[model samples]
Target: MTPATENPWAFFDRLYCISLRDRTDRRERARIEFSHMGIEMRVEFVLVDKDHNDPCRGIFASHLLCMKKAIDAGARQWVVFEDDVVFHRYDPHILKDAVTHLSNGSTWTLLFFGCLIKGSSKTGNPRVKRIRYQALAHAYAVNRAFGEKILSQPWCGVPYDTMLRELSDDYLGTTPFFAFQSNAKTDNEACLGLDRFRRCFGGLGLIQLMNEFFHAHRLWVILGHLAVLTGLGVCIW
Candidate 1:
């Protein structure tokens, strides 16, 4: 039996729908969609509580805290969702199976759907097969062992991509990491909105555009745009 069959709601259990204070509707949709599917999950609003003036670090810190909470709850598997993601043609069963495949493989340090498609340069260990970029936390899952591995790693004071690169190189070297292919051909991304991050920040230069296109996995761009716009949030709810 699958994990969801045992718990019915196991896929959604301990899921944290990370969002800003202004994104109540986005949170609501994510929460309701999962609930309707008999997946027990909750939405927790997150924002900088104080005027620290550091938006980037604050967001990462909040994610770490929420992830720790899920781990503490004895969650063997957990999903992290950003506000703007909407599953148009997604089947919960298929998603569950995909996650199970990665988890059961046991060689991967992380399983995510968003990342830049790149070739792996660091080659030493035979455990890993190849390297690709763009694994975003949005709509991603981490097995129990992966959680522990991440927790044990030192927190790097950089963007999520840099941190993932470092972690993949050091820990998951040569391991196969499953990340989503973002183009229209991979999956039916009907509800997926425009790639705003590429439009906004990517215009600085070719290197910058290429870097963001492949590195951040564009999940943050989707979620960040959702938070900024109240009603424009794409949702699975």
Candidate 2:
């Protein structure tokens, strides 16, 4: 058992990080970050190979697999992180204080270090707060029962964060997020036919064009061009 004075993170049975097989760079970053936080020994890496068809499904499968692994390992409290995770505000007692104020996580179903707030959320304690829904499963903690509960359900696909939120009746999260997704190439993007086209076009051009034009003027110019083309087509017809 972790001593009462120890940080709440000490109570976690293990910390697992999910990374793609090719992302050793991400793995090393986690290693250095964990060592900085003095928790390197607790982290275990789960390497996943991306599925050519869909990476999101691969992400979902990896998370489920982590839950199963934790349960099998008899982990009572555990944390899961994606390779892109970056820790923020590292101190011995910052997170400890939040956990302590929340009755030391006695009522926690899911505890998130990184999550996106939705409309259904209500504001209260920033240190430790209740949340209706959570997204961005970059970093989150789970108890043994919580892990088991998630595993028991019939689930599929990515957007795994939202799925957990729907299943979780009692969830808690940190405000000013304790973790963040690093500004790196996203591994979970599934580029399908139309999506690939959209991405290609979206990133292809027009930084200067967007900067030069006001929103309304841009719209008007586009409309004017369309009208001229329509008139020419009508004349030709």
Candidate 3:
């Protein structure tokens, strides 16, 4: 195991963390835990006002705000994380190695250090794998090129992770996640419901499928999947 003190990658210097103002306790805990693991971060509080009616919207807005801040700061590459993330068990060496591999590749746009879904063997790389559908925007890194592209676009109503998944040509995820939410147990019920829904109604759900079909240019793939699912439904009926 690599020593926590030395972060091999310079990209870590540009780390930014997003936390809600009212959730200082979670922020402090994350800060303390990350520090103990030798990871330093600049924290930005996402203050939710009356405009942000939905908590999910507030989260997405905060992420966009952080990306803009990174651009203004002249950062070429940066990492962003939510306050609920725990970094104590993260392997800095693996992250650095994966990033090094990705830096050599031209297709990758975003590198997810932590995600809800893992890529299959078809999408696997030596250091990273191309993700199909990743949820949870807990922790990720983006280059300035990708950041600018993201800022140029309007806010799509989908969740942050889904938006990234759709935009990037090759969204990479590490085999062993670099970070994890401290409050994973709290979201178990929600995850169970989502899993059930995905299995029964097809992946991404009907609304998200329609949204992706409309917004993203990759229509044939979505259409093909929908057709297959329709056939299956008809056969079952």
Candidate 4:
């Protein structure tokens, strides 16, 4: 009675990873992770030296460059990864489920591998939920159409991930997310003028665990927060 879902990968054409030439550490980590997951991908270079400019511009340009290359290479759907990507709960079978929630014969514009996304989905498979936008972009898939749309947008010095946040439709994400960013030095801190490898609270394992739970039961977590807020309100009254 429902359209049989296909693994999100079923919809992709090719995978590409964006990496800065100097960050061999991140590239190596991603390489090992992919080898473990049986992922094959091409590497795209982020040649911009983000030190002198707003790093967001460099990020946006890097993403656009990858998209251009993918489209040029005849890939209608492309999956892009940053070197910080860390896989979780990956199974080949999770690759075969379908998550088409748009409409009859409609397709998604963007699909997140890991993100701090907002909202829920009752229509699609629970494992594949529709979402509003990405708070993070370590990993995601994009259709050529949406990729072109993104390319068309003016960077204007805004954080590229912030630009992603304004998208409210045609976005889908996996639950128990297939990947997340590891606690590695990244633009998350560099953009703030912080030094590389900033020590995160509770360390890398804690960060990964937080993403695991959030991806698995984000709605419940949101509701729990709301309940606590309401209880506090009642106590104050």
Clashes (backbone N, CA, C under 3 Å), per candidate, total: 13, 0, 0, 7
Better structure of 1 and 2 per TM-score: 2
Which one wins on TM-score? Answer: 4
Summing lDDT over every window of 10 consecutive residues in candidate 1, give the lowest-scoring window: 182-191
Question: Per-residue CA lDDT of candidate 2, range 18-114, in tens?
Answer: 9889988889998887787777888899988997677667777888889999999888878998877777665556567556654544556777776
- Tens digits of per-residue lDDT, candidate 3, 92-121, equal 667766766655554666777666553333
TM-score of every candidate = 0.56, 0.73, 0.67, 0.77
lDDT of 3 at 41: 47
Candidate 3 residue spans exceeding 4 A from truth: 1-6, 41-52, 105-107, 122-125, 184-237
lDDT of 1 at 105: 46
For candidate 2, which ten residues in a row score worst on lDDT? 203-212
Model 4 pairs whose backbones collide: 5-97, 5-98, 6-97, 6-98, 7-95, 7-96, 7-97
lDDT of 4: 0.68
> Distance from true position, residue 16, model 4, in Å?
0.7
Q: Report RMSD (Å) for each prediction in the order shown.
A: 13.9, 9.7, 8.7, 4.7
Clashing pairs in 3: none
Give per-residue lDDT, candidate 4, residue 220: 90
